[model samples]
Target chain A: MKQIEIGHGSGGRLTRDLIKNIFLKYINSEELDPLEDAAILNLRHQRTAFTTDSYVIRPLFFPGGDIGKLSVCGTVNDLVVSGAVPRYVSLGFIIEEGFSLESLEQIAKSIGEAAKDAGIRIVTGDTKVVEKNKCDGMYINTSGIGEVMRAMPLSNISDGDAIIITGTVGDHGTSIALAREEFSIEAGVQSDCAALHDLLTPLFETDGIKWMRDPTRGGLATVLVELSESLGYGVHLYEDRVPVREDVRFISDMLGYDPLYLANEGKAIVITSGESANKVLEILKRHPLGNNAALIGKVSSKCKGVRLKTRIGGERLLDMLEEDMLPRIC
Target chain B: MIKTQDIINHIRSLVPGDRKVRIMNVCGSHEHTIAFSGMRSLMPEHIELIPGPGCPVCVCPESDIIHAITLSRRADVILVTYGDMLRVPSKDGSIRAQGRNYKMITSPSEAIRIATANPEKKIVFFSIGFETTTAPTAAILETGVPDNLYILSSHRLTPTIMEVLVKDAEIGIDGFIAPGHVSAIVGSNAWNVFSEIYGIPTVVAGFAADNLMLGIAEILGQLKNGKIRTGNVYAGVVRPEGNIQAQNIMAKFFEVADVNWRGIGYIPESGLELRDEYSARDARKVFGLKEIKEEKIPGCICGKVILGKAYPTDCKLFKRACTPKSPAGPCMVSMEGSCNIWYKTN
Candidate 1:
């Protein structure tokens, strides 16, 4: 096959050949064939959930992990938190010309490793390259598919589901900020980039999980707002219970940023029945990734929006994050 | 290992009387910790905690940012700073909102790296912060072979502000919660002048809930004993003499000067200016911005908030008109601002 170039995305035989020869060869599963504008998959019995996300993090490599690992972990965490068992992921890559082959290989390997860790498969993918400067090294887009098992009963999510955040927020964003060539600090912060499905398996085995979500682009604030709008319920988070790393806290303080609004690559926020909350926390605490996990708040019937129960027993509204603080830092 | 409850009990014991007292914490990190950890909840009803102007970002005037932005417009100068200052807006525009004329940096050492990498372009780091950040800036100066780089130092000293606050402020504060990190550099003795002259007690407290309450306890203890003194609850990181090495470095490259704070107005000798020996790296020397005037957002109450003359909520723009997403004032824009803290955690 002819070596593909940026021209392939311009609509020609190069695009067809690249898709058929590369994408199909690797993701030759029956369900992922791109017959139309989209891949149509049949769902026989289980409830289905779908999500799409794009990763445009810079530097791409840091103390603990890289963007490839982040792309997969982020999307999988999303599916798992939404009360679904992640089954498959479709990957897309936009590469800059002159990018190193070795780096590409490493990234692909990390993606594979992350998929295995999450117990999901990369069933389909596409790749295209643009001239140097046309792309900032690389960008990845992922769409996830998950199955809501028939045997598992999903909570309709009533007024009193407890809100639990697995691990600290803002670690990944802070690590990325520290790794930036421009910024430097004494604190050693690493990206909290990992798969949370292993931690979620036990919780999924429980009977009270109502709604769950991984706080990604906008962190926990966005997640709470979504739940509040959807369930028509209120959330009261205790500022004290939220787990924030000292390094993360310091950097945010120094930069005038809030950890609550920062992004997290390897974390999940689960909302379950208040009665099952303790049991779910017990399951999570036994897992390494969730040792610092906290039951930061609970769903309330009165407030009707996201509110913070101050350490002083006062109330404050948690607003949507405004203009991105430290954009592209994640 | 110090639990928040332990601190609460200590505070309760210290404030056993029926009289009301107020304490102000000056560090931005302290503000962040107090808000995030919910430390204010543990306080007795009579003891009210107040925020200070010590947040380095909150205190930096908008004119300085305008000056830095103007210098950054120079094709040869690469503007550097910690990420927090990147988005801060000036009268003309924010360095970020204006575009890529400036670079957001993490540390002073990275500015050195950028200078090293470019070799040709002049790099000017817009150094802003208090004692915690001043040390790194001092480190860059000590390295000494300065040829292609400069620092526009807006670094302020905490003690100077404290002196101004204790003498003139009508805040009725019974004591002071001196900045813990700053105390580690300038030493506990630095605040002795304020304590001796004003007869108001001071305590250097750590950021943790227990540490803060302990500092408050010690200050109250001093009040009960009728002895005004400087106490250190953060002795682990702070000391009576402070970090001598950092002090020496700061004294070498910069000299104390009068500078205008964004909200608090001008306090004599409160800010650090680049000494003549390092004048070549100074942006004011590179670009004549000496004529620039201090301008503030009209009707903004950041000044009153910083001076403890008014609470953040007392400002007309405070949640109703100004917010973190759309800040109408400098204090509302910064994480250390009392308004920001109030908004983040009530």
Candidate 2:
């Protein structure tokens, strides 16, 4: 019998397979399209974006944010990237029997503060305490609902569309990795986990916005690869143009992790027409969360898969992440 | 401050337009730079950059992996190794396939820490790598490991494999881009025989695009002048004599022995074994481990792929039966392996 491995939850090829072979196989609904971050449903003549995400990050308290904050931001960003104005979230906690009550309270406080900051409300909540070792300290599941303010369909994406990123990539993944204290090397890198609703709200007003995705789990490369495969178009990314922090670059290089494949929390990959590219970039840069925003790539019909233009002016194809990022043996 | 463009242009100007020059890199990082940067696409069609036996994990003997898996299954033992080694498949299945009792570590020191933490458990550190990683493993041993900590060394010498590649007539390697990090320990002097005896142009290169391009240009320059010599373009880190202290430490701990490489038969003096003096801390000795006959997964050309005899695409199973998600061969398991890099970038 095939058993589940850790890679299945790594948001790579295995995760895609698990969703396809199991989740999508049984849970058949037109609204349950796995390609989009959130489900778009029409309820009482109103289009609503519904998304749910679970947080099971180890060392729940990391450099920049804790599990509470991450739980709120992750789900909110999903709706935001789906062209929705996130308004309500239902938080569910699966706490281990021996989890510290003080830590639980602290997490609850963080969730409230984060929800307030994102302009969303925790309208409903549920809690369950499991036996020790049944859960890893605690796991938070948040299902978010938001009004679909705009419909940015993938059909609008075409050849020559611009791919813009809101900020630097890999901060969250790097910070979390360091927080685990696996490698002794220390650097002052923090997670970039934050809600993207405020920062991305302005882009909704702009014209030619094709689609947007929060490059969270599998990072920017996976998002683009999925986009290319789904649209049957090509994504040409200028690798050097993709914004990466100096510390992120150093840590990733030292650890044999690619910054392009590392997870980013407060980032959105926006696909827009070439004519509106400059405007989208300008709007992103104006937000504090998007100070490092950049026009990284463009869509093209010349190729079928995602291709990267390296700094040395060479081109290479990029595939969706297949496994968890492991440190290379020299 | 050499621009990549200038180096490319220089290489273009130096190469004889009609000649076929096959340069092989015996380091995973070098192949990674070449594949990741799409350097092959930038090069002339006549110039083929082949990835050689650079991935230590890919070439790691199946017997050692099987032994490690068996040791990991023991109730009193804990198997620890580099993360890259977990997914490599043998007839018995990968260490990861067993799922429990094995811990992935990034450095050798973590083995000591784990050993120290769990005094009751027999901590078997399944150490595997080339000289770059071996130096650190040797250093950790010199520092004195805990009583419970044992080492299962699958360390292979890089220069020895490179020698095997050159001796293989079918591969036809015209030049070599020697591994940068390995040379930092083994030194550029270690690769002298390639240039001096074999008359193959060799250049030690760092993993940067411009630096690699400079190395390529130097090789082309030597080919054009018929003056084959080993050159060091990564002088910023790799020294001619290397870290003498590291070499001395390695010499103190390990003795060269004939080791079996997966897909390839035993190569003389190609592997490092723990000395008799350290037998007490050798997992193979402590656990009375026996080597099982190595079995190759059918239709997997990982052996040919590692020796640069064939490309990943040449394998009928490539991307069809073997992939990173479900690697049928060792080459497809590690990110540093040529097949894995090819799969990711191609």
Candidate 3:
């Protein structure tokens, strides 16, 4: 009945009508006043790392988890990668005016459950309405602030360090890509978007651990390039060591996408010394998140840039990600 | 396994310089491999791998997309394609960008079924992908489609694209890192054309960083020693002739036809079309678009990029206005489009 779909985004009557009729009834948060651009939160932290990201993933619901779970886990992973124990997160929802209230409720409940699992509070939030045609079914923007844990020297990444990946690559991005029904392949795939801090907590305390990073947006390639740019060191990654699912590898061959450049929400790369590398990996393997963790390669002071060792005893230079393989795939 | 560091040292010895030698890979899988290995930081200063138009999703032309849009809006049609084609742009708009009605699916088999289900609606599967995808499209056609079901076959053969690049004097490509899946389907015979015509060394590569690096090493070796031939670095999957069954299926349902590449004009006998037995399901024939002209997007250098004559960064709209979200050309849409690959990876 509502022809004015985007009108709900204007902070006018439709916004208020939708919130009062739908959100307020489902969520009993006293701090989430639907009108404000920013919400005031009283927290007990002096230092905070604040990050915001928009989730516009298609097919909101997937095999393992939906966009709701991903929204919370993605933010938690971000904070954890930055060496911050996540404290609290704020979610903003922009819903198409005519979308089902049931879907919204289900998403909200998921957000609540995910927050609980990560031990973070959704202290405050906002909701806006957009016309059905103007927006996808729903768009979520989540911002979180976390307190810096014991100062882990992520900026101290140097040459001759070891590179460790905590599990396989390409699951999250490939899963989303496949779920979009964009390619023709039959594979058992699921999103790897779980909170990674629990696994990372031990690594932060390890000796010679100079830097830590999560392979997200541009996947492991972006992380590798970013490290090289910052530390001014060449990296050597073992091709056979990088663990990837058989199905993902098969599909990657079919579609011509490299599993490495594919995104992983629940994976990270740690740069540390050769001595501590095995120890850190052993400790990591003990954790649930780091079960598939392996020493994929080493930090090389000899090579001045990134390069890959071929399975057939050949060598080619590896480069930074020049573009997105699966755009908006995350 | 040749350890990653040993290869790095060898490459350092090969391309010794004050600053790293930047080697741009023109394939999407290479981009992914480079990224996953974090190989950029792991290599010597004399080697830098840049991304080229390897991701097909990044470089698909807009004219084809416009054609898809036109077909998607038909009341008698339900368009189907791989996921990447949905958001790609055309002269008018994208099939999904325009909010046009069309179904996006992973399989050509699914498109065949949908077409059969909607017997009244003239279903057109927006066919795309390399040899891996062509097999499915061919399989569906060889099996058969309803009279109303048609396919606007925009599928291109990989070797033709490679031939176009290798022969291009302006491309400046010293060697080629041949596609793995395409090589698996079409075999190394297709690449033999490159060695025969242009004498450029071609390496059949795997998706792993090590495999790709080996392919690159072979290419660099060829470049250093002045050799020209096809090397199957990816012996794990690729063979000299490729998958015979897939080739048979393709040959059974379709024939080589001179189809238009969005930016690169028409390469003679480079595209696939349904044979006479399956021509009734050809969307172009059913829709009376036998005369569909390849309309070039104004001021777009996608054609030049596809030919490897121009780098994506050379285009004025490479980053500024023409992005994946608001693509001005087809090269900015398809995953394998050069511009899209550069924009996403670089």
Candidate 4:
């Protein structure tokens, strides 16, 4: 019998397989066909974007944010990147027995503040107490709904479309890895965990925008690969044009990780027409969350998959992550 | 301070358009830089960069991995090893696939911590790597580990394997890019025999794209001048004498001995084993484990690939029956393994 492995939850190929072979087999629906972060629904009087996410990150508290804040922002950003104005969310918590009440209150306070900043309300909630050892400290799940502002379709992507990123990548994943204290290296990196509605909402007014995605678990590389595969177009990325913090780069190097595949909580990859690329970048640069926005690459019709042009004038192919990146022995 | 592009241009100018120069890199990081940075596309058509046996996990003896899997199966034993080693396939399957009680650690010190935490369990630390990792494992042993912790060492010597490659007539490697991390501990002078006796140009290189290109340029420069010698382009970290304290620590804890590689048979003094004095802390001795008969995975060309005789694509099972997700061989398992790196960038 085939058993589930850790890679299945890594948001890579195995995760896609599990979703396809198991989840989609029983719950087939056209709404889930696109597999976008959030599903678009036609309500009685308005169109809506709905998304749900769970936060089970270890060390509940990290450098820049906590799991409470992450859950709210993660769900809110799912709607924001889907071209929607986030409205309300429902929060649920599963707490382990003997978990400290003070920690719970602190996390609750963080959730309140994050929701407030994102301009979303926690309209409903639920709680469950699991026996000790049945769960980690706590797990939070959030489902968010928003009003669709503009429809950004993958079908709109065309040849010569420019790909832009909101800011530096890998900050959130790198910070989480460091916070685990698995490695003895120290750096001043922080999690880029913030809602992107405030930063990305301006792009809704712009024209010629093709698609948008928050590069979270599988990272910018996976998102691009997925986009290319779905649209039958190719992506060419300039390695030097992709912005990464020096500290994040140092940690990833020491730990044998590729920053391109590392998670970014506050970054959104925007694909737009080449003509409007500079204008989109200008709008992104005006916001604090997108101050490091850059035009990293463009969509192409010549190649079959993602290709990266290195800083030293070499080119290579990039594939979807297969498994969790492990540290080398030497 | 030189620009990477300038180094690339210099390499282009240095290479002869007609002659085929084969340069081999004996470090996984160097290959990682080359593949990840797409350095092969930048090189002249005549110059070929071959990835040698740089990945320690790919060459870790199948017998040792089987022993680790056996030990990890015991309810009272906890097998701790480097994260990459957990995925290496053997006759009985990988430690990750066959065992329930195992932990992946990034450093040797984490083994001691795990031992302290699980006082009642037998913590077998499966230490494997080159001199760079061996020195740290030796350092951890010197500082003292808990009574419950035992070591299962499969550490290989880098220079000895390079010597084997030099003597082999079939693999005609014209130049060498020595591993910088190994040189940092064993000293850059360790590779002098290849340059002095074998008359092959060797340059110690770091993992950066520019440093590697500079190393390649130096190798071509040596070939052009007919004055080949062991050169150091990663001079900022690697020194001629290397880290003396690390050498001393390794000498204190380990002694060189004949050991079997995964695909290659036994090579004399190519591996390090714990001294007899530390037999009590040796997991093999304490557990009375013997090296099992080695078996090769059918249709896997890892043996040829590790020796630089074949490319990963040359293998029939590369992307078909074998892949990073379900690696049928050791080479496809570890990130440092050439097949894995090649598969990623291909």
Candidate 5:
């Protein structure tokens, strides 16, 4: 209790406590992003969205991208899914003592390159240094500000609304976990860490979009559970429809982890009117990041929590994840 | 697809409508498959699939946890266990929440690695699981262990608890979906007692959608035809005689002992302990820890829940006092536990 355990940063129960007891107590949740990814603020006559996220992954550089690129992509993706056109993003860094200057430059270059790819600018940034062992080799935080192109409120979501996800699931979590080489499991899975602005932009044009979320910390089930719980609706997801890579699924099975519960850095959950699902999916598949997109489930008035209709046609509650073993792996 | 539907229809036809038929699955993995696959919804309304004490973590006695915790409190001991045992709460606290030097592992083999890496510190593998896991732990022992490596075996026999369940009249389990993994060790012949002696039906099924349905269907087939026999639908893995080598390895290092079950009181010869030859590597003997006093969690129905006599929702503390995040007893603590599986899945 003296110092925080690894679970406090797990983005599950311990993370909730840190937020509810510390962050939410001092800062109202309303001021933050209702989705908890980024904040939505009305500036002048137009609605603007803002979001901030920190990247503290081990190794700092992974297969798909480095922490710097991830920091930028994560913040911008939050803004994008909130139906915002990401415009400007700020960067912040906390480096440990005796860290390599060359590595710092490499991370900085990765950050700049990622921002360029997402068509966002580095408007402002901050830097700090801590003693060795006090911090990891490096930690990064990125905040993005964007203009709301349209509104896709959870309030508009109703029974019969369909839930759609972009591309395969569990790549980011699986990639990072495998990179650790803990269980002697080897897989050629790459992290699906990229900006979603291009993939989600087309859907923003459609008025059928009820609400959108990026399933990051707790995967698709968490976002669905949170949205359903908030809106007092039940979700029925088809297990077969959820697209997860075979290798990822294999590793997940070997480790007793659910791919639905694993983190996905490059996936989006789109809730739209039932009739518009095919149209939205068609638009999404036309993009690079969303080629494997699918209409996975629908909002139901059946029950309060989420349920998964497994491949065998049996139904079970897909409850929100509890405390998993590791956290920063995300 | 046609085969599954035919099985489903046959199962539905065999199920008598007047009274409820409660068929219990005593394997944690089986319960997970049933819930995750939505197998329950496919069954007829009168057919109820109850989870038994198949989950090893759910039935691990609190005294073992107390013993592990006391050892974890030591400065030189590093207690290693599978993740399921971490969150179970006892009188003082759980091994994860309260222990000073405890680490979560995927298997017992990691204990060897931990022991090798830290030669100066003593490594005590707090082993807890059913036969599927126990066989592996025993195999690791046959290969030999490091000097500092010790095992705090909390493994329990699944058949013994199933016997306990049948003895309790409160839980009228009509049949059993015998744990396939356990059957792989003990064989389909091991569960013949339930069918031959107790006059109940037992089916050894794998942890798959089709396999489980076929198992349930086979049980219903027996009940409808008034037949009592031990069937093996998971023939690919389980035989009439189980994996003799793994069973032999288990017998080499351990023996059955009367042990206390969490919530459920002492069940005679229900647990496995290290034999006298392996006493040097037994942490319980090395630690000299004595008199493990068991404490009851007030208002907890975990004992009856694992016995299949009550549902998780029937517990007063369920969702209120006990949850997967903060479990008060072993039932709500393990993912395989009847309560945790029901609490999360249902």
Candidate 6:
């Protein structure tokens, strides 16, 4: 008998193998097969995107947001980035038998409020309780549906395109990490969790927008690596120009983490044409969610891996994550 | 303000284009800076930064790993070590890939907690690293340990191995960007002999991009004047006299012994073994696992790679037979190992 390892849940190479061998073979449709974070389906002369995400973050709550807010934003963002206007989301919960009723009510209240904040409805949901030994304290899953408003494609993404992010990176990761108290250091950090439908909607209507992705697991470097390999073009990031929270930077140095590899919930990594990058940045800066947006780097015709020009004066490749730097970061 | 561009300009003004300088840095973070900062883009085309065996996991011999893996398989033993050593490849398989009940720790002091939590099991703390890391482990040992705890000492001395590098002229080391952390513990004045005896200029610098370039600039200045001297440009943290208390603690608990480096083979008096008073807590002696043998991967040149004599890509197994996920050697395992750093960055 073989036991499962933590690597199986990393959402990197090991996770890829697990999904490809076990799940995709049986349940994957053409739209669902590629695993592009969400599936876009055409029905009755209407285009819509459907996505589902599970939130099982340990401690159930952290500095900024809890599992409730994460559940809504995580699913809604999946549909929002997939070229859709988020319409409705359904929630499901699995609780241990001994879980507190007060915690459950608080989670439910937060989820309801989050749905209102996103301007979406929690149209449906289900709940279940399992034995204490068989489960964590709480786990929430959300499935979302969004009506397609405009077409956003990645086929136009090529060399010379610029890569940009919404705000300071690694806040979500650093927040959860500090909450773990693994390093015995104190930092007043919080997760950047939010619904992006308002901020990203205007950008959805803009030109030069080739691709969009929320760097959830594996962080920005992994996203760049995936894009580079899939498109066969190199992704070069200006290391100094990459944004990170000052506190997160200090904590990362103390904890030996490369913030580039930390998770981000409220930020989006976007690719746009070089011709319209500045115009796009201006628009992104105007939005509240993207006030700190900056053009980090551009696509290149160099090595087929993610490259970083350091703040000091060295250049190197950024490899696809081989192992989980922070497990269950999302 | 120590501007990197001004330092680069100074370096450029000093070195003739015809004289290709092969500078070796014996620290992982330095290699990281060279790659992460694209610092090479600033250097003249003639200057090349070669990575040395400063990374402890890169030079950890395979025999110790085999022993650790064996212990990991035992029902009564819990092998505790740093995260970097988890995936290191041995003849059979890596500790992460094959072993069971292996726990990862960030520092030597954390072993006490793990040992306390697992009171019934034998907690074998796999203490493997250089002097800077060893000093902390030694200090903790002096504080005392749990009765069920043992230590597998695989510590190596940095200066002794740097001496080994100088003796091997084929390494093409023009001068050294000395490891600052180790120097901070071993003292900056300790590296003078490389300049005094081998005529190779050495500069101790911190692990910052500006610090590295400035150190290289100073070395270039020395080369231009044909001056053989050991210099310190990272005086902010590193002093002529290092942390003497740390040095004394390290010396108190460990004795110098001839030991084998993974790829570079045996180097005399370059290893640190637990002293006789601490033999009761020594895992190697207690387990009677005295005759561990080194096994080589057929075509892997991690040996040459560790010595700064060859690049990782120069090896046949770099991306094909070996990778970060499926590593075939120690160099590909550690986050700071030259192979791992080069693969991820370059």
Error of 5 at A92 (Å): 1.5
Q: Which residue runs does candidate 6 get wrong by more than 4 Å?
A: A1-45, A301-303, B71-79, B92-103, B112-123, B143-149
Spell out the clash pairs found in candidate 5. A314-B38, A315-B38, B258-B269
TM-scores, one per candidate: 0.79, 0.86, 0.62, 0.85, 0.88, 0.88
Better of 2 and 4 by DockQ: 2
Q: Which candidate is the best by DockQ?
A: 2
Q: Which one wins on TM-score? A: 5
Tell me the DockQ of each model, to 2 decimals.
0.26, 0.60, 0.10, 0.59, 0.56, 0.52
Once fitted onto the true fold, the runs of candidate 5 whose alpha carbons sit more than 4 angstroms away are: A1-46, A324-326, B1-3, B75-78, B101-109, B112-123, B146-150, B277-282, B285-287
Which lDDT tens digits does candidate 5 get at residues B1-346?
5477787888889988898999999988898888777788999999999988888887787888888888899999999999878788888788877898988888778899999999999999999888888999999999988999999998899888899888878899899999998999999999999999998999999987888999999999899898889999999998899999999999999999988887788889988999999999998899886757788889898888788878888989988888888887788877788777777677
Per-residue CA lDDT of candidate 4, range B1-346, in tens? Answer: 7988789889989897778999999999899999999999999898999999999999999999999999999999999999888888887888999978999998989999999999999999999999989999999999988999999999999999999998887888999999999999988899999999999999999988889989999999999888989999999999999999999999998999999988888999999999999999999899999988888789998988888888899999987898988899988888889999988899
Proportion of native contacts found in each model? 0.27, 0.86, 0.05, 0.86, 0.84, 0.89
TM-score of 2: 0.86
Q: Ranking under lDDT, best-scoring first?
A: 4, 2, 5, 6, 1, 3
Q: Give the residue spans of candidate 3 off by over 4 A.
A: A1-330, B4-63, B129-132, B219-227, B243-256, B275-278, B290-299
Q: Give the C-alpha lDDT of model 5.
A: 0.83
Q: Tell me the lDDT of model 5 at A110.
A: 80
lDDT of 6 by residue, B31-146 (tens): 87777777777788888888898689988888898889999999999999999898888886878888998999988778988899999999999999998889989988989889
Alpha-carbon error at A153 in model 4, in Å? 1.1
**Between candidates 1 and 2, the lDDT winner:** 2
Against the reference, the lDDT scores of all candidates come to 0.78, 0.86, 0.73, 0.87, 0.83, 0.83
- Residues forming the 10-long window of minimal summed lDDT in candidate 2 chain A: A22-31
